[model samples]
Target chain A: MSLLNNIYNQLRISHKYVNRLFKERSCYISTSPIMRDLMEFFDDKKNWGATEVKTGRSWTKDDLRIKSNTDLHKLWYVLLKEKNMLYTMEHEHNDQVRLFPSPERLDKVLDSMENLEEVVRERNRAYYELETTEIGEQTHKTITGPFGLEIDYYETEHSIPKEVNAQWQKEQNTKCRPEDVKSFLLKYKEKEYLQNKKQQRRNFNHVIGLLNRFPKMDMEALKEQYPDVDIEKAKASRKYKPPLVFD
Target chain B: MRLTQILYTKIGEWSKKYANLPDRYIKRAMEQVYWRNPKGIQYRPNTVVKRKKFHFTLDRPWSAQFAETNSPGRLHPKVFVEPIKKWSFFRGDRVEVLVGKDKEKQGIVKYIVQERNWILVEGLNCKLTKLDRGGVKIYIQEEQPLLVTDQVALVDPSDLKSTGFEWRYTQSGEQVRVSLRTGRIIPVPASAEETRDYKAKGLYVEQPKDTSEKDLGEVTFEPTLKTFEMEIMDQMGIKEDRIPKKSYWY
Candidate 1:
């Protein structure tokens, strides 16, 4: 029993020594020399409490389109890190009751990320279109709902076939009473009609105001601006008085 | 879908050009949202009650002074602006004053407020105002905006006289302002491209955080038949042996 205990102690010391050596080797094997500690989640120290942190505009879609997939993949992470850092800095500043400098930086990063994603999606779409007849995007369809309003329904993956799924089939079949649907649709249509009429009236009045303000204003430009408004009818309105002529 | 969007569109593109700010930033800085419907099952989903009409003055739309002028519970009188087919006035253009005390005086265009069809000519159309500072009344000359339509006329570069100009295409398909009388092309001034950040785009100083121009200009993309995902996975040495199960999409 004493010998067995001594051997166990020897094994434990070796294990400890091996762990220390492995850790020392890991320190040398680190990919980046700059330690990626928690401090990376914050902005540069020099930028702290700055009034304005000037930066260039966001990356354009055309710029990202020329980058390789690997470059885009790397850029995605860089932008993600920047976004996280900005958010952390913003939150910290808000907590300290300090003004966050250059809030537009966040927007710029977001815009770049959006453009990068769009470029990636475009590349994917092109490949899919070449390989298959479809665009290979999530499928969706517009269908009339129970209230007779058009609803965009995105297709989702299901374990069972749609025809065999009784619960989904029932949900799809669920409908309001015909009379109730008719009443709802009628009210909806009336609301839409009133909105359109109000828009037309507003356009007519605005055109008249323009005419009253600038007598020699370009009529062609006015017509182009307010395409739905009847220019002649608006001119005939009492509110649209013709400019007085003086010799 | 919001009324504020339509109203914001009234801000002319030329007015925003000199600011060198993103459209999103301008919209964010200027927008005054009094109330917004809370999320989840709202009767009018995404309905926002915001300031629809903004009083465009000499102050820029994104400035704090402009925000204060259009602050909550404040409504200015409706301003009727004449719509033009195209904006002709730009910064740094030589113009002759057609009205007021500075009539017939030629000055370079200093500022533009295109929403109101207004321009401020340098050292012209001055309004002297007395300011009280620490019991001392100081008289300062302030530049007032002139109506671009009737109060100012573009100066003919050849004759140095006020003349009407028409936009015409040059032999190289470049649009240019041509003097109606002299038939000489009034080239767009280099200062017209000047923004708050830089005198010109090429002269812009790169910030520390900005990507280097060399990196931006590099073309590293190779024509690959694989999709982005496939290319990325290949680079990472990730292989998928198991095929995804066929599932019904409904």
Candidate 2:
């Protein structure tokens, strides 16, 4: 049996209800006045040919937090509507080859929605922590990627162990090659070395240039700009000769 | 009741005058048409008529000619509840964008295109739109405000001052630590000499040379929260339309 499948089975044995809750919430669709408003996220049939549509701002984190859960639910629809409107506008814009005005509005809404979800999750965590000892059960598993980097995989309680089950195991393990690894490591090191060397040379050159340009360089400003460089040694260098000759 | 009786009498008289036509049907059509297509009369164009008609001869070149500029202009019909003259919002009222990067960005609405649902805010970001076939279009819109609710700063009524005031970070205003949007506390200097030093060095770098150069621009001097109060107000466009004296800052 795969380790992840085993973990999922174990989790299912304990917190089966929470998993159900997540599934239910994810699938649940609201059809209310607020939801109707949020459905505005979709473009109208009449405006299908239009390349652009005007819209207001996304709901702020502060705005969402202050509202009661009921209000939040309603506002969710509002935001959802705005998202649909933006999507429709974006789709039309792309189709007609026009610039969608305030494209950042989409990102803002997405950010706001994400933050709202995070806040809800935080509340849910607190509630679960109060009732149950754990912050619910975080489905976490560590696995090496194709590049040999370790990543955590969240586990959920399921009927069967993933690794033991052929289908789940296929989903878990991804394909990787030894030659690709060697090449990746080589290129990664080379890139790292280049970046460091470039930064070092830039700093060294800047120090030399500063000393050359401003012979009586402000001690504080110069030191602040290049903290690692030995300012005294840079000043003493022949390259540090100022444009004005000393009388 | 008395007004209804008079209308019936008038209708009866009109029916006898034009006896051949159906009086009730004609009255109903007139009322329905009046109810449906009532448009406010505002601007009108005058037409001139020529007393004599002129004739022109056509050349028999045997060439077919087709009119190309026959595409109808596009328009979205919308009814305005109020007239433009009645709208109090003026061109000079400064609009300050209340969000990041463009926060406190102030501009005046140069022209209000009521029919088009557009306002030309001077100095705000404007874009020239190019159509697929040809020609360019211009559009102006307001910056969206930051979505926030609980992060609103609460001020104590007793501590209100003309120069300096107290602000709490949390919604409840019970917490001691305050978080500024700029991610730093308002600096308060110790003396007049320190104040001058702070202003000279404390000036935020408008544009840093590079990411590494940010640390170099950090000012050693600190100014009091009082000195920085006006800067916030000036940047926020509060001098024109003062923030409510009692309302909480969101």
Candidate 3:
């Protein structure tokens, strides 16, 4: 279903581009060969069975920042198609038990998509901030959950107000009892405390080991690396014996 | 801070540059995640259990050889690495060996394992290894890594002699390595820009899917007081006559 939706969207975009081509009658031409079929999901035939597919780095936020909104809209679809094609290739290779060449290509595409979205968001934010007093992004709030833990709750559009919504009010009610919530919070705090203590102990032991090995090691650098570990305490530890020197 | 976060900082920038792989890819390839917190409600959100202590060697952190050496349940002996304030050694640097049979021999740096402050100089310190394959004995000389701090010294380009260097900024505020002996600039070699993808940035071969330099550099944007969606809609000739109904956000 999603694949069919993607195909429909691609066709609409291509149709739009074709219309624009006729309207502008400019020398703008796409370099890549357009299959306009399911084959578009796969990579070029020349890239098949290749040991490595060399590609340039992702589009950085700075690079995308200079591009116009129309250009960014076109680039978004380009990236979406590339991402789909890469995914199809990866799935096909996995099915055939063949190694996917340059798996980092997927990461690069994802990084580019993220940067592009961020750039678009930045532009939108700037315009919104200048016109309105808000950045005009999604609204979220830090609220206490039933489990006594903080939750980042993103606001959703609702047809009715909160006071009039009986179902929502009932669903928002705490499922756990007061005693249960109290117990859970107590245990959670204890667990957090234990974890912090364990980390401190690990750092202390590692520092002692370092002192034992490198007797002439730079104390300042060591302290900077592990600020929590007390160098004086680690030095005084029985495990941190100084290297014997013979006169 | 998490152990993985600390380990990530240990990976040197120069070492990453040589691989030319994204940090996300490197982390994904190298990490051994035994367990992870699933989506939805949980006691500890975003908690993960994974391998922390990685044995960084000549093999890249993302390479198959590195995975094999650091396979599950394989524990290596603890190695003590001295903490340095700054990393000065880089690839394509000419350095003279201070120890072993190749002592005083000048060679270019081939590889660097910054986690251990180790660098492999071309044809400097070597170890002979005999490989027996199909009843045929073949002896090959393999370059061994030397400590950048003590086992090797940078070669002064001015007199072609081994000399200590200091990092200094020029009049233009560009930081460069300067030979202390002659006070001459030890320029970073052009070969240092070489990576797994290309030898140099300008020399990179653009793939079929890559955007062309001409298209990428073209200034298509003209500052306008419009939101991205509004501009895109205008370009697409989208008309919205109906006003959106007021909705409550919760």
* TM-scores for every candidate against the unseen true structure: 0.89, 0.36, 0.87
Cα lDDT for residue B173, candidate 3? 100
lDDT of each: 0.86, 0.43, 0.86
lDDT: worst 10-residue window of model 2 chain B:
B54-63
The interface root-mean-square deviation of each model, in the order shown, is 2.2, 31.9, 1.8
Candidate that would win on DockQ: 1
Error in Å for residue B123 of model 2: 16
**Residue A145 lDDT in model 1?**
74
Question: What range of 10 consecutive residues in model 3 chain A has the weakest lDDT sum?
Answer: A26-35
Q: Tens digit of lDDT per residue, candidate 2, span B1-250?
A: 2232232223222112211223332232222111232343211113222111111011101111101111123222322111111222223434444434554455554443322123344555444444454555545444322211111121222232111122345556543322233333222222211221132334423322111233323333222222223433555566756564442111
CAPRI quality band, candidate 1: medium
Candidate 1: global Cα-lDDT? 0.86
Error of 2 at A73 (Å): 2.0
- Candidate 2 residues A88-154, lDDT tens each? 8788788878766545457656766776776555555665666675675464767565565555555
TM-score of chain A of each: 0.87, 0.58, 0.83
lDDT per residue as tens, model 3, A1-247: 9999999999999999998877575334433455356788998899999989999889998888889888998899889989999999999999999999999999999999999999989888998899998999888999888788898888888999999999999979846788998999999899989988888897788778777776767788788778788888888888887787555
Local error of candidate 2 at residue B105 (angstroms): 26
Q: What root-mean-square deviation over C-alphas does model 3 reach?
A: 7.5
